[model samples]
Target: MATLVSILLLLAMWWLTMTTGALAISPGRVVATLTGGGTRIENLVIIDRRLSRLLAGSLIGFCLGTSGALTQTITRNPIATPDILGVSAGAGTFAVLALVRPETTERLLGVSTTVALVPVAILGGLITTGVILTLGWRGGFDGYRLVLVGLGINALALALTSWLLTRAEVEEASVAVRWLVGSLGGVRMGDVVYLAPMVVLAVLVCLRLAGGLGALRLGRDIGQALGVSAGRTEAGALITAVALVSVATAAAGPIAFVAFVAPQVAMRLFGTAGPPPLASGLVGALLLVGADFLAARLPLELPVGIVTSVLGAPVLLYLMTRHLRRTSV
Candidate 1:
């Protein structure tokens, strides 16, 4: 109920933000615009521009949140997330590469560069995840080892991204920087159209696997005893998480920490031991929309990822300190 209310409030804020800007419109006018009863300018600004951005931000948030919850559950670690596990970094690196070096990707993939971003990003994320899993596997998945490997891969991906940026032309490099920072400024309805269906499909798969994922928190042996195929369940969950993060990264350039922070925040709000995938997705949507709104309102408009990182950094520190203290004890 609280989550529902929070979502409603965020939706209201999102609508308000979309409707009002340089040329302000009232909430009533925004509603009328949505319902097809607004001036040409209002329609152009609200329907064409802001609505697309809002939808993109919301979907990206939902994907990240859902992916984050699944990742944390899979690893049995509160801080585990796609970003920390190098999935986002890998996706971002490949997407930027595709953007800056279109002909190379076009030649390799036998497709238009425009059509290759999501697929390349997904491939990168999957490959990175496979490496992390392989390096971390020791008879069974080890949380600490997985995190360590993921961090190393993340560093490597970042270095590669920096190198790629250096290779880009000045204009392409500027575009890459905005993408790296994660903004919705360039998003359009076409981008939303590409993102929404993938998110919906991934989300359906997540809902179907939610029960098995919940069982995973009890450990592999117990989960197997409960009739869950530990291996298959883990594989399915990881694939879904990778797909979710990949599409989200492809859409918004790897918005940082939404995946890491949203699930933890949802768990705290609901007072639950395990991350709730659906609720966490909603929380993520709210967080991103709110962050985008705040980012736009800043003296100089900032990337939504910058805002989320600012909010999430302190939370990350808190979680790390708590983890260290618990381990020390």
Candidate 2:
């Protein structure tokens, strides 16, 4: 009931800002525009453009949030996020490469290969996740080593992405930049369609592994003592996390901070003692919806990623401080 109320409250807030064009429009007029009671242009602006983008942003946030929680919990590390594991970079790389491909460009917006951008993004994400997990698992997965190796891989993937961006055409580079900053602008239902299946799969995989995640919190050796196959559990978690982030990033670029923020928020709110997957997903949806709503109202018009960063950075700092204090104690 509380969750429902919170969701409604957030939605109301979104409607209020959008209607009032807190960023630009009068509240009543925005509603009229969406309801088809306003001018054709208003309908085009509000319903066709803004609403679709908002939905996309919310969906992307949800995907990243849950995936991040799953990864953090499975690894027993507060710092674990999809970005750290190179999934976002992998997705970004594949998308950029597709945009630069002549066949893809000629056939579609930038490219027209038999292989679509979504699949390429998913495959890349999976490969990166698999490699990171394999490297982290030495006899048994260690969270400390996992975080270190994941960060290294993420850095390498980012370097490759920068190089690819340089080699890409100016138009492709422009597209890539928008993706990097992670905006929901200009998104359509077709793009959402491409992301839906992967998100569903990831969610299902997470749900299936929830029990294992619970055990993982007690450490791998203990989990193994309790009949949980640490290797399989870790592998499943990595795959799910990668798939979710890959689909989300592919759909809306890498919207920075949602993965990190949502899971942390979930852990705090639920007092899970670790990550809370379901709570993380709900928080993620709310965070994105709220952030996008506020972004929509901004005069200078910041991207959703900017909003998330502004909100997430402080939380990250707080977490670091807490971690340090705990370690010293």
Candidate 3:
């Protein structure tokens, strides 16, 4: 019931946002446009422009939130998000490279730039995750070691991304900067079309694996004792997390801390001890759409990522402080 209400509120906000951009349309007009009754201009603006951006933002948020829940579940750590774990950084690095140096990626991958975006980003995220898992492995996953290695890798990826930006043409750099900051201003229907199927597939996989994931959360030995393949469950969760984060990053350029913040917020709202994957996804969509709306209304028209970062920083700090207190106790 709560989730349903939240979704309705978010949809309402999304509709209002679509109706009130540069060339404002009223709610009735926006509804008319959707129902094929508005002027051509209204139809174009509402359908082609605003709706695409809204869908992209919503899908990205849903993916990130669900991905974050999976990561935190598998790692048994509240802070184990794609951004903090370097998955987003890896995916973002490859995505930026694809944007700025399409020829290089094409030459190396023997695929056109358009065909390589999501796959290349996914590969980067998987490779980074593989490295983190390998380095952090001490017969099994260690949350602390995973975090340390991931942070290190994330730093390296960011540095490489910065260096690449420095080498790009001025115009390309400008475009890449907007993407890196997770802007939704220029998203089109094609992006939504490309991302929607992938998000759906990933969500289905997450649902299929949810039971195993829950069992694994009871600890490796206990899960194994209960006939769950701890290794398989962990691997599945990691791959799902990577796929979700990679696709979202490719679509929206990391989008800051949505993955990290959404699950926690959802857990709080639902008063659940474990991350609620579906609810988290909804919360994520809401957070992102709300952020995008605020960004559009802001005087400077900042990227949605900036808004999320500003909001998430305090939550991250509070989580860290709470984690510390728990450990000390």
Ten residues in sequence with the least summed lDDT for candidate 2: 106-115
lDDT of 2 by residue, 209-275 (tens): 8888888899888888999988899877877778788878777777777898888877777667888
Cα distance off (Å), candidate 3, residue 3: 1.9
Task: Report model 3's TM-score to 2 decimal places.
Answer: 0.95
What residue runs in model 3 are displaced by over 4 Å at the alpha carbon?
107-115
Q: Which of 1 and 3 is the better model by TM-score?
A: 1
Question: Could you estimate the TM-score for every candidate?
Answer: 0.96, 0.87, 0.95
Q: Among these predicted structures, which one has the highest TM-score?
A: 1
Top candidate (lDDT): 1
Error of 1 at 225 (Å): 1.1
Residue 67 error for model 1, in Å? 0.4
Clashes of each: 0, 11, 0
Q: Evaluate model 2: give its TM-score.
A: 0.87
lDDT of each: 0.87, 0.76, 0.86
Question: Which is the better candidate, 1 or 3, if ranked by lDDT?
Answer: 1
lDDT of 1 at 170: 89
